[model samples]
Target: MVRGRDVILEALENLNEDEFKRFKHRLGTQPLRKGFSSIPRGTLHSLDRLDLTDKIVCYYLEDYGMELTAEVLRAIGMLEEAVRLQQAAGQV
Candidate 1:
């Protein structure tokens, strides 16, 4: 499953500064999906989520047969909402 931890893990596996920066740019933007935004709100610290999401995407595409589709991004957005739900319920 594509999770935030997975994102952090894969990116660090290679540890290339320039490539990481490039990924950050590509996945950083408004509306979230275009920039590989997984979290629902595009606010401060949400970029952190994007950075993680980017890594997960990279890994998923490699091990599994998948592309960075807008729909897929949107679906992941739902997962972010679930986190908020858990937090709201004081579960996080």
Candidate 2:
């Protein structure tokens, strides 16, 4: 079985620099409430793709991490990537 972390990493790797930046921006700026918590700007600022993937998995675990990744992807207009992630994560 494909691990959720690997799925997320692949999705992030598919992004170009600009799309990755938008993904990071959306993740960092999300309002904290209930089940959603935003990563600090400083924390996200220096992360490369692998580091960001690790952080998401560490912060939210596999299932929620994948979901959050998809959410951020969708927010950045990476709808195809989001759907791919959702399918990979078994959310579709």
Candidate 3:
């Protein structure tokens, strides 16, 4: 079953860099979706959660199917190695 997080995850996955930047700019102004509220709202170092969110989104821009997991790994700065392992494992 598709959940609200799934929808937001898909949307983030599809957005391009420019589109994501615009989206971030408009995020506070946009009407809140019930789905988005559940995402954690803090920062790591000086980076906003939205920045990590966008990276996760961008990571799936190609044919990558592991968007959610990849992005979470990316958020913590481990996406590259993880993708490499995924590729080595023939999972990507």
On TM-score, the leading prediction is 2
Determine the backbone clash count of candidate 3. 0
Question: Regarding lDDT, does 1 or 3 come out ahead?
Answer: 3
Expressed as tens digits, the lDDT of each residue in 1-92 for candidate 3 is 44323434444445565544444444323333243332232322233344544543453332332334334334444545436434533422
Better model by TM-score: candidate 1 vs candidate 3: 3
- Stretches > 4 Å off in candidate 2: 32-36
Better of 2 and 3 by TM-score: 2
Query: Model 2: how far is 75 from its true place, Å?
Result: 0.5
| Candidate 1: residue 79 Cα off by (Å) | 26
The count of residue-pair clashes in candidate 2 stands at 0
Estimate the TM-score for candidate 3: 0.35
Better structure of 1 and 2 per TM-score: 2
Task: Give the per-residue lDDT of model 2 (tens digit) for 1-92.
Answer: 68999999999999999999888989987654377567778999789999999999888888888988888899899999999999889832
Candidate 1: regions farther than 4 A off = 1-4, 29-92
Tens digits of per-residue lDDT, candidate 1, 1-92, equal 45434433433334355444444444344233233434333332334444555544453342221223222333434344333333332321
What are the lDDT figures for the candidates, one per model? 0.37, 0.87, 0.40
